[model samples]
Target: MLRIFYHTKYEFVRWWRVAAGLTLAFLAAGLISFAVTGGVNYSIEFTGGTLMQLQFKTPPDVAEVRSALDAAGIQGAEIQQFGANTDYTVRARDEKQVEAQDAGAEGISKQIASALDAKFGAGAVTVVRTEAVGPKVGAELRTGAAMAMLIASFFTLIYLAIRFDWRFGLAAVLSTTHDILITLAFIKIFHIEVSLTVVAAILTLVGYSANDTIIIFDRVRENLKKPHKGETLSHILDRSINETLPRSIMTHATTFSATLALLLLAGEVIRPFAWVMAFGVVMATFSSIYVAGPLLLWIEGRWPRLDDAATARAVRAGEAAAAAPRGADRVSAR
Candidate 1:
């Protein structure tokens, strides 16, 4: 078996300042993005626009499709080839532009489909599907997405508390929240549209972040029982993290590589989701070690009682002693 090497005595907890700095930086960028974009630049799914899927008998040239749409005065349209080179998905013009077009979103979709068919030739292009969401439906979806994220976070906190110590739970929750904020911040910076898929990715990231934290916390608990006489809590935490470093690296690297592949090759329809997932995998890994571990240590500093893994071991030792005496006394009396 190959052994993974790490500095068991290294003081990772002492570098909390580095984690704090990165958090502040992400928050600042997110705030700037908020001001610049006038809140999130939500995708058609949340802002109400037309989505059209078209298929061609032969591969269609993207530049030709763009030219046709431009000639038809459809500005700000987003288009990408999906699945096969011959199949393409086109988003209608931006919400403001689509709303200004007479009639409704369906009218806009028909116009775009007509333009593509004209460019390719009669019957060369087929409209596989067209979807139009209204403003009211989008608003409801936005509200529901927000509520879903909150509910997930709430349940994660509850589960961690029950499974480990309350301090570990609190630290895990905070670290998970940090991952969400950082991912959202990058979404703003990159102009990745906020959609239902992205929301799902964020929810998945919450669980991923929590699971990683729990792993490290569990190891910390196990190590506490056999601490060397002179070892400090900081040393124990560093040791625990080092011991689990190999497993964490393998899990995180595998997920990160898969998400990266999606971001690069999955096309624009899935790009927002992929970008968020890829960004999230990196952030979750960092928080699992830097943010979650340091927070646990910080809590340990403020309230030592919350970090009492040794208490259980001490109780077990006392019970064994009591039982041994009873057995020995009975033997002597007999």
Candidate 2:
């Protein structure tokens, strides 16, 4: 018989500086983008806009539709095929167009209908749907989304605190936030419009990143209970992550594969959503291992008392459990 063994001693915490520097760079770029762009470019859903879904008897050319809208003097109008060649969605903010300042939501709808009717004939075009959001209503929805995310983070912290400890929850939350910041930075860099769909993606990443962090933290807790000889906190964290590395890699790989497929084949309608999700999964995975674990270890190093008490308790519990089996064996022998 032959015995084989592998030694694992990679200290992820040691590279904390590299991770921190990269995060700082990302944030700085996002801030600079904000300064340059005036803010995140919000979609019509965030800024008040008139949205019209149209269906024509004949398949309509997107360029012609855009040209029709442009000729109508509807500046900043965005036109795209919704699901089929004959179906299209158009959105535009209120702007001076041919002295129609009094064209309210209904008037805007009529103007769009008139423009398309001229191109495709009176009875050939159908107004499938129309949605108009006022600036106040859009602002409220945006604010509500921000509040929902904040409340979610608060509850996540409480849940983690009860499950593990305050330090674990704190670290996990911070890592999730980092993932969001990086994702947002990328969104800004690419000039991707921040719509409700994008906000949903950010929230999805928050939950996902937290789950990954919890898995790693749960493993760390178990490892702490069974102290390895000559293992420092950093070593234990490294070991915990190493043990979960296989699972982490497999989980993220499968998600990435799916998301990448969606990005390539899901069509323009969903490309932005898929792209954000794809970017988010990668960031969440990296933050769980590199950012969350290192931050926890750094906290322990700065305030030893915080972890020392928990460590001592775990050691005592482990020793008592070990003695229990011995005591039972002696009794049975007697």
Candidate 3:
């Protein structure tokens, strides 16, 4: 092997520098966005509202249906079509409060039906589906989601520590947090609706972030058993990184490709989620190889031994020490 690794030290070094600079910039932007936007503007799940998904026998008239709801005294109600099909999702404050007449999905659906009936006739329209999630349920969901994310971060940190080292785990967790911040920053900048679906996407991205970090850490651990024990720490890490880089690139590339396809093909309802994943995979890839892996060397004090030979040398030296002490006692006994 013509030393495939460490062949482009300058390139990797510059890459690391740029990555660090970009990370700092990202954090700054997140802070600014947080200050400007006041953090994630959570959807009904956090703000207290009713989510009613509806399906009609025929594609309903958006303007007429909205007008009917407005006439019924509903406020801040949103109606949008979903999928390539003729389904619609309606979200609003408590239907009772909005309409002020003990309005539930039952009542709202009837009004929507009546409105559509006027447009398309009674037999021509049907309320095929209806769901009602109260504001109280939405609040509980928001609390549950936050708790789930915190718990997930905790468990992920623990897993990284147990599997590799505490430092690696901490960095991995931090990197995941970074990914979340960037995702939220995008939401803020774009003014995207931070709905329950978005929360679900955030949690899923957390795991995706951890998975990438774990892969590189696992490689570092394996390299620890090799014989190149006396190599420089940066060079050793560079080699380990190079060895795993292909797999990381391939995995993220495939995911990115799929997410891009979804972003292009899927409805706007799903685009935000797909966009988050697409962006997250790229960040996760870099953090795993650069932040999480390189962090071990920097934090624990690097030596040039992130390879199998380096590990073998250490093991051999330990064994020799153990045997030598015993041999000296035997000689004295003689």
Please give, for residues 63-155, the per-residue lDDT of candidate 3 as tens digits.
Answer: 877876776656557887766456776666654543322345356555555655675566764455554445566667878988988998888
Q: What lDDT would candidate 3 get against the real structure? A: 0.63
Q: For model 2, how does the per-residue alpha-carbon lDDT over 1-334 read when each residue is reduced to its tens digit?
A: 1111124456676676787788899889998988988778777566767888888899988787777777776767888777778888888775443123234657667878888888778998899878776676678788988898898888888888899767677889889889988998999988887878888888888899999999999988888677366466666778888787777777898999999998989876577888899999988987987899877765444333323465444434553124211111100000
> CA lDDT, every prediction?
0.76, 0.75, 0.63
Evaluated with lDDT, which candidate comes out highest?
1
Q: What TM value does model 1 have?
A: 0.76
Displacement of residue 120 (Cα, Å) in model 2 is: 6.6
Candidate 2 matches the true fold with a TM-score of: 0.77
Model 1: lDDT of residue 14: 68
Give per-residue CA lDDT, model 1, range 56-132, as digits (tens): 99997789899999888788788877678888888874656556443565777778878877888889998988877
Task: Show the colliding residue pairs in model 1.
Answer: none
Error of 3 at 184 (Å): 2.3
Error of 2 at 19 (Å): 1.8
Preferred candidate (lDDT higher): 1 or 3: 1
